[model samples]
Target: DHHLNPCYVCNSTGHNCRALPRMRPRIPDDVSPTEITGNGLSETEPPVLEEEMEEPIGVEDTDFVLYVSAVETERCRRGLTVAYASHCQQESALDRPVAGHANFCPGELSTKYRDLPSVLSTVKHEMLHALGFSVSLFAFYRDDNGEPLTERRPDTGNPPLDEELQIHKWSSRVVKNITRKNWMIRGGFMERTFHMIVTPRVVKEVRNHFNCSTLEGAELEDQGGDGTALTHWEKRVFENEAMTGTHTQNSVFSRISFAMM
Candidate 1:
């Protein structure tokens, strides 16, 4: 199962795949203000226009765009996999993701699976990853007011990881650590550690779901190595939820998943 995890492919390169060059607005050539204003015309007079200015080049009309493609592969033919996706490019200023790519396996596109809830859910799940619901993109997240969740490097604009193996980056407002103790039937107690998304909306939903007012935040998957860890909801805590690392027969797009988004 670890070998089949998709994040290995999604984050293969260590960075969001080579970022596309940023599009900068092209400024128009200089034009004299007086020449367009009819040579010292009075305020009461209407200004004569010499030419109409065209809209600036390279101005984007949309905030984000995702490019999807289907590719047939032997692996998909043999496995139960659906698709894989990743953010390909991101805006430099706020490190906001502006472009991504999703690759659906053509081999798995059968008529039987068409409009099926499981396949549709898988599509939505991969799209969410393409749209920044990823560990690689976590460092680039922004607050409601457009501030970076994690501090970024001035030169590279990427968040520095705390530990290469375990902790990547931490934003107290977005994610936090929690300790849990579970009593074993045979012996004493087993201690477990978890990272949680402590954002207000997510915390509210989590608390309401578990009926525990003191719950910190929603739990994130801490297993499955780099492929499944940190980027998804913990399967044990949120079984059958669409955002969990592994797909399930009865996965649902729960409110907690939406709130985390």
Candidate 2:
């Protein structure tokens, strides 16, 4: 059986623990008002009826919750996917996720390979994706001061469209372009370009990791199409990092990943 525990209950730090705030669903503006009681009471009635008071909805006092489940899938058997995760709900006030879901494939959970380091790392990696590491959530990110990093529509509280009315999702504050050179077989040298996350903490950590003071930021994965591109670290640069697109033996949760968070 799968046993789950609240992180706040298991945390030893008590008040020092920085946790995600619980999100409350917003009520629709078009909701009709509650009907008054004893509306048709005669004027001759001796006693007047009091309107019943409605109790306010209470929200749980805890961090975000992640629901995990195991299932069988063809992708798992074909070695195409081991697990997948996504945020299911977001808090309107902060624009951050309050709940997420992760699905694990039973085929990849065989007794023989379940205990492997790579397998364990894959589980943690998927959990990270559920939390906030997603391209879809980038536009909702906020800065240290609780302000949105990307401009949003005041009415819908969502990212606004570009001049051409195209969906503009990525936050310019998070992603930037950097140019590099690649030696090609046919061409002597070619200018290769890709996007990178230039958040302050990410830039500091990556620059220190490579001991390059002039470096702009850490590179993001440009390959692997929609599933892998922009959402993960570049495989060639971060071969064994847990946030990379492909899992490798002895995968490590690097400090750079934490800095990105």
In candidate 2, residue 78 scores what lDDT?
53
- lDDT minimum window of 10 residues, candidate 1: 1-10
TM-score of each: 0.68, 0.70
Those runs of model 2 whose alpha carbons end farther than 4 Å from true positions after fitting are 1-59, 74-79, 161-168, 181-187
lDDT per residue, candidate 2, 103-184, as tens digits? 8887666466556766778789988888888877777777888888888766556786444423347676888888777736
Number of the predicted model whose lDDT against the real structure is largest = 2
Model 1, residue 249: distance off in Å is 2.9
- The global C-alpha lDDT for each of the candidates, from Candidate 1 onward, is 0.71, 0.71
lDDT of 2: 0.71
Please report the TM-score between candidate 1 and the true structure. 0.68
Most accurate candidate by TM-score: 2
Cα RMSDs, all models: 14.0, 13.2
